[model samples]
Target: MTMREIAFSLVAVAGLLATATAKAQAPEPFGRPGASDAKGAIELIDPKVLRVCADPNNLPFSNRAGEGFENKLAQFLAGKLGKDLAYVYYPGATGFIRNTLNAHLCDVVMGMPQGDDVVQPTNPYYRTSYAIVTRAGADLDGLKTLADPRLAQKGRHIGLVANTPPGNVLARLGLLAAVKPYPLVVDTRVDAPGADMIHDLEAGAIDVAILWGPIAGYHVKRSNGRLVETLLTQEPGARMSFRIGMGVRHSDQEWKRELNRLIAQNQREIDRMLADYGVPLIDEAGAPIAVEP
Candidate 1:
């Protein structure tokens, strides 16, 4: 063969080898369903869909129309990732994490409290304080906060949902005598009617109620301005606010890291969402006492 022909053959072989190498190094498509990559903002596979588990009837958190604060956050995440939002609804009851997210039925939980709970939380998106909800037109003028000594006075029954951190906190503070325990009826579907407790409150069966911020806020709003007076409490340890965050499966470290980044970048928007839902702005300690109007 001529020298030129030999040289040409060698060049062609080298070009073919380079092409093959480049193709091999390219990233494989994302394995999970509904993953995406939006212009390199985050490394996601195409056709991304964020499968979020949420409650269908719970308000100020999530609902069927995706109107809740967490629902909006999920939508925002989907938009940030350039993916579609898919929801799996289950009442936010007990065993939700284990039965749903842990079971791999959904990829994320919208509002898991940050702590050593069933699932791990990403960075907190919003903070809220426990508020004291009372019957409409009731006098909270002297209450000031949960630490008010008047709460321990006779005839003032504090209604608390059963088996929650607040209930436990109340017990630790030596306030259990003043508390009227209402079996937790949400999420667990324990055959107890939450409305019964509320009814009892309306009938003057209970003078006060201590519930989580979201639930309290929701009840106050739904009362149509009738259930008046919410006092921000300063009960010891009650001052410690629970940080609600998104939860991912324990094995999803990569996904969790990505979610934390997204939360950090959009903290302001998240705060606004919580507020728009009537979730009171809380301090680091989670008490709703001194939030600016």
Candidate 2:
């Protein structure tokens, strides 16, 4: 079957997992879902500081050392607002939002998906898609999509984060039976699946690896041109791309609006930051963000 088949069956598998994970990971309702009462439900915190909640060891995204792109982005936002940047460290897994944002440990989450129910999202500053990583100038040089028949060829092995969209796609294509599935629930202190997948690809343990665009892009850059990445822009009637935005508590409408304004006003700067970190952004039309030669 082709990726079209993967596309069709993917919804079922994904929906099942999303539902299960959400239910299992769901924290207490965040003071209502969408709109929040600023005076009652929301706690008034110091608006002069950019208190960002983030995972301390999730790289290409965040870390305690202020080396990740999200940390840099936070610093930029804080600078724009003329506020000091502060962090509330938490593992980005189940109850992350509940324990951090909801509990008022911090004011914002710098890199969450748009439309996330746990918190209100600002207008997305950038959008990204899944990426395919392979050795540069290799036989898979021109491979663009998971639908490529070459992926099913003899002796081919694929690496993917288990229970993700790409993993669901591979499973539907009957490729998962041969693919090496990396655990999604990793120990934040030790493993970084995205970096690990790229490392495995470089070491010849896997033929190709499918990963989120930003993660793949960042590692490929750090790989010193040893690896190449192409954004997967086609899904044949499935969602493969997502818009990323910062999240605030649902009751923080004023805070969300202020952030939306900041995002719009500073989008160019934000895009530059993302590009510098090797995030593969795409236009709303699903075209790749052009890179200057």
**lDDT, residue 133, candidate 2:** 95
Q: Give lDDT tens digits, candidate 2, residues 1-293.
A: 33322222211111101111121233344453333444322433555667888777777777899988889999998899888889998765556666777777788878766655556678988888778999997899988888899999988989877656676667667787669877665446576677778789999999898877777888888888889998887765346787778877766776788889899998888888989988888999999787552
Q: Candidate 2: worst 10 consecutive residues by lDDT? A: 11-20
Q: Write the per-residue lDDT of candidate 1 for residues 232-268, one digit (tens) a residue.
A: 4455553334455676665566778989999999777
lDDT of each: 0.56, 0.70
What is residue 271's positional error in candidate 1, in angstroms? 1.5
The TM-scores, one per candidate, come to 0.71, 0.85
Screening candidate 2 with a backbone cut-off below 3 angstroms (N, C-alpha, C), the clashing residue pairs are 36-251
